[model samples]
Target: MTSKNRDLRHLHEFDAERLITLGRAVIETETAAIAALAPRIDAEFARACRFLLNCQGRTVVLGMGKSGHIGGKIAATLASTGTPAFFVHPGEASHGDLGMITPDDVVLALSNSGETDEIVALLPVIKRLGVPLIAMTGKPRSTLAQAADVSLDISVDKEACPLGLAPTSSTTATLAMGDAVAIALLEAREFSAEDFALSHPGGTLGRRLLLHVSNIMHTGDEMPVVTETTTLREALLEMTRKGLGTTAVVDADNRVAGVFTDGDLRRTLDAGIDVRSAPIAEVMTRQCKTTRAEALAVEALSLMEDHKINALLVVDDQQKLIGVLNMHDLLRSGVV
Candidate 1:
């Protein structure tokens, strides 16, 4: 790096307070702009929602420059939240992607000035196609807004940039408005967590909601288990064999009677008990929290967290041990 650039970097690092103050100012400004949108969310906002809800096809979002970037994100959020939507660049639309729009589709066009040339140019074709148009713009009287069937104002007081050129507050407001519309539609459709999980099968949300205890639990021979009649030494051996740091103590009926962990072994050692001969039942924790195989893995994580325990026994309806799971298992499964 040049000497001047290095000096500037050092100055920036040393002036932490100034950096924080500037950051706070930008956040506060954007926050106020978003707050201003609430009162304006009147009949127009409701109409936009109705247009989307009544749409038989998809919600096609169009924009130019920074608005296009925000439009893409809005489309993705809407799609994931149960509203069928996709982003189509205005420039691309004129080049032939306009065929993506159907008469049943609802077109949501975004332009801060409401006079984006590409979007404005396609107004006649969109109208001719008989598709419903919803315009989100800073200027309600601009050409695109004038051509729209319904216009929702996305105006902001000022840009966070001192030059008033960068799209800071405007983009934040637009994104927030997109979220508001998506959530409203989501609630209207009574979308569930499972529905969201289906849309995000590879994400953390899917793992938490769709994965069950049975999907990640160690079963059959992998279970570290011993009978009530077994010695502490024998239970310790089982724990070592399974490498789970704990063992379930079952009764003659094969029902989980208690759990013996390394912690219990520590206490046994502190008491100077004869582990080789002492029955595990005497030292095992009888009030163990167990889960069903069908229970969500996130629920199992919550149980472990609430009880400050690291492992649990999976049981059937008859309270017979079916499987075993530990914090390590949960971590490996991305459920922790």
Candidate 2:
């Protein structure tokens, strides 16, 4: 092996218990820091939420370095939870990005020292714009905190970093505090799941909540259907042609009367019935589960699961067959 490989293998030879102990210590230290922040969610935290909730415009989040990473996540959480927010690097703000901020906007600044040079430099401009300022910092008496309309304390007892240089507990505490503020505003605004789905239309939850039965159900000639008086043989042919393993049995008025499926055929053969001359109505399941085209696709999935069926027919208010859907359709549409 090469010298470098030998060195890497030697490094790996360190006691495994030592590595685990170190990892656990970091987690425990960060956990304590987050726990300490819970009690600090006082009147000031409420005032911060109020400011963000009442803002007529977006919340412009500003931070530097490690705090900037945390701020971006906080901004995303806020935006997805009903608050309009976005992150702007403090350094970029000094280079004309400050134009993005408006008098109607609220500024949330984060800096562990409360004196990040870039953010501190933008204070005069923000003040001149008459925008409300909310500062999140470890130092409550620092310049950024003193200039803010409300200051949030994100202080940690110590760094999880053994050398006390890297951001560990401080960043974790900041993130937790940001979530507390975002969730508090979410509850205050009574944000619902539907509202959240609108912001995440491409995610799984959005597919489940926003997609309706009409969007994925087979309609027109694609639907497998037969008249109530159709021969059992003809219903089986229709099921094969549509590949849905089931066929809707409708009355003379095109109203859904019952459903015939592959399972019914098996039962018929087992009972020694003749498929060539038997009527579909005799073997079709009466009062089969059905859904409306306008209902959510997830609701249809619920019905199929609850009734232990694999397919459902869509009907109108008058119980007329409009469309047909099977478990395969839901699986293809990501509703399953």
Candidate 3:
């Protein structure tokens, strides 16, 4: 083996117990650091939230190195939760991106030392713009904290990194503090699930919340429907034609009278009833589950699941058949 390969194999020679203990130590250290931030969520945290909640424009986040990565995540959490925010790289901001910040925007800067050169240099410009500045740093008396309208102490006793050089505990503490601020602002704004869904329309939660029965239900000719007086064979034919495995049995006024499904047909066959002559009304389920067109598709899914049924008829307030949906429709629509 090559020298590098020999070194790699030797490096991994530690027993499983040793590796596990190291992993657990890191987690415990980081957890304690996050716990330490709870007491620090004082008036300063409230003041920071106020600045963000009252800002006319977006919250511009600035950070450098490892802090930049944490800032990006904080910005995303704020934006998704209700507060409008985005991350701006400190180095980039110096060249030309600084113009992106306006007087209406609030500046949130993150630095472990609160003395990151790129961020400290922008302090004068941010102050001159007359916008509120919020600083999250380990040092309370650092330049960034002193110049800010609100200073959040995210200090950690020590990092989980054995070398004490890599950012571990401090970054975790900062991230937790950011989440605390974001959720506080979210509650203050009374942000609802529907509002969050609107912001994340492409996500699964959005599909479950925003999708309605009308959007995916089969309508008109696509719906498998037959009159109550129709023969069982005719109803089966309608189900086959539409491929929904179920057919709505309606009355003369097109009102839903009952429903006939493949399961009902099995019961009819077992009862020795002739499909060609038996009226659909006699075999259809009189008390079937249904939903409205305006109902959420997830609600329809829940109703179907509760009733142990695979299909549902959509009717208006007058009980007239307007549409029909089945499990396959929901599965295809990504609402299942």
Candidate 4:
């Protein structure tokens, strides 16, 4: 016998064919559970969405054990998407955590057996406070279902676990249903991507969605600048002072005439020109790429990418210089 077959036989006492059949059954049960949930999204789901959308306070998600863990995740999803929500442990709710829930909040309770002692212990408090309760349970006829304002039937024909003790298929169905509720409310609220980005300011999505060029561009005296008539030596002094590796060459009006960067300086040095007295405008890039102050930082990134450069000047509509932006700015802003 193969080593794999021997190992399987030791614990399961089953042939390879039987193990394969069991795995297939587990997958099928969960698949069927999801498909069944699709048709049930008509009225009750709409009611739940409306309740959550109009909730005057945060949505309080509560569950016990494995369901509690799933509740925590669902709470996070709801909070970041648009709705304000948080998870409270059912066991804690009976002691003092019930204070975290308020009259204006909506309660989403999860229980597989629908009679989990910890979950049942909080029902009276939820009722006394008159917080609308949505119960997600396998047994709709159980105590929790009867007490709930809306009962979401997450019943699976059977668990994938052969012993029928583990909470696998049922939990998946419940979590899927929870996600459905959150997304439905999100759509009804007309929540924008920018609103979601504000909630996730620490992530890459926030960088892309919330960031604008004005936030990262260097302004005031920090920007390297020299008059167009200024010598290459004067321009180099400004670049060194700002340490931005580039200097703007401006006309008499302070409008950008050209740009001289470290790259241009290097080529000028290679040509062995008179760096001391040469006018910067003679050597500066006359057609340097620029960005507007109000542009998205993402747009600045695209401009840099398409032009294969590292820095850009921020300008106003009348062609006046406002700020300078570089790849390091993009890096610091999490826009890179």
lDDT of 4 by residue, 22-76 (tens): 8999999888887888887878878888889889999999988889999999999
| TM-score top scorer | 3
**Model 1: per-residue lDDT, tens digit, 211-328?**
9999999999999999999988889999999999999989999999999988888988999999899999899999999999999999999999999999999999999999999999
Tell me the whole-model lDDT of each prediction, alpha carbons only. Answer: 0.94, 0.95, 0.95, 0.90
The alpha-carbon lDDT assigned to residue 50 of candidate 3 equals 86
TM values, all candidates: 0.91, 0.96, 0.98, 0.84
Deviating ranges (above 4 Å) for candidate 3: none
- Which run of 10 residues does model 1 get worst, by summed lDDT? 9-18
By summed lDDT, the worst window of 10 consecutive residues in model 4 runs over 6-15
**lDDT tens string, model 3, 54-93?**
9999999999999999999999999999988999999999
Residue 290 of model 4, lDDT score: 92
lDDT of the structure predicted as candidate 4:
0.90
Q: Give the poorly placed runs of model 4, Cα more than 4 Å off.
A: 1-29, 233-237, 262-278
Question: How far off is model 1, as Cα RMSD?
Answer: 3.0
Q: Candidate 2 versus the native: TM-score? A: 0.96
Q: Worst 10-residue stretch by lDDT in candidate 2?
A: 10-19
